[model samples]
Target: MPDESKLPISELQPDQIVQAAITSHQPWGITANLIAYESVGASLDVIRRGSEPGVKALAMNLPPVGTTIDLAIGALRSWHYEPWVWVDLTCP
Candidate 1:
């Protein structure tokens, strides 16, 4: 497997998905850790214990248009929150 952090857009192949993570975050006022599938799914690991992991997922429905994050990372692909390279790659 390729090192996700070091992987660049130029090295990405067609139809590939990458996994990215943030240790702690409060997206939309909810404190949690984020695991974006980058336009495929958005997995939110709740900060507090006892809460179901990924309580809210983008796979079910997409956020409204023009939302920078939404536009940057599509619904579900955000699994659904990693920074997918091919989705934004500028080929030479």
Candidate 2:
């Protein structure tokens, strides 16, 4: 296995699927700590596969905190001191 702590998001393959543990919920989405990339987290702003633009995704159906789920990489964004990952749900 690769050293997760040293892995960079830029090195990930396109549309790669990864595991992440749910951390918390926000009004916009859920926060999850990634398993393949230690110290890295993803912001699942768009939970559904075909959610329309401007439509709000409901967190009621999302996994609860501590649950590990598979997600597909959407993009890499920088919001603060480090690069943040944006992911899409890989399963229903």
Candidate 3:
């Protein structure tokens, strides 16, 4: 990865904020996956994951994620699998 420590902050607009990767989260257990806005002192996030990349892409593109777009969040497991005989629900 690039040198995050040296990431620039000069281009930020008057009303905008810089996207950041939070390297610290002690008891909470959250990590670098979380993005933050240092100017606004808040973290950025999406409500839910879409079925495909398109819906998610559109959401970010409409307002843009900025130069730090390279830093994106994703799920560890995007899908699930089970044997056909398996059943999550059954008659008592």
TM-score of each: 0.22, 0.64, 0.20
| lDDT tens digits, residue span 15-55, model 2 | 67778788998776778877756455576774453364322
Q: What is the lDDT of residue 53 in candidate 2?
A: 36
Q: Which candidate order results from sorting by TM-score in descending order?
A: 2, 1, 3
**In candidate 1, what are the lDDT values of residues 1-92, reduced to their tens digit?**
64454433344344344333322234432211123332222333323221332233442343333232312221222123344422321111
Predicted candidate 3 versus true structure: per-residue lDDT over 1-92, tens digit per residue: 54455423233333333233444333322123223322212222322333335435534443323323223322222124421111110001
**Clashing residue pairs, candidate 2?**
none
CA shift at 65, candidate 2, in angstroms? 0.1
- Off-target runs (Cα >4 Å) in candidate 3 are 1-10, 14-19, 23-40, 48-92
Tell me how candidate 2 scores on lDDT: 0.62
lDDT of 1: 0.29
Q: Which stretches of candidate 1 lie over 4 Å from their true place?
A: 1-5, 11-16, 29-55, 58-92
Give the lDDT of residue 13 in candidate 3: 34
lDDT of the candidates, in the order given: 0.29, 0.62, 0.29
Model 3: pairs clashing at backbone N, Cα or C within 3 Å: none
Cα RMSD to the true fold for all candidates: 13.5, 4.8, 17.5
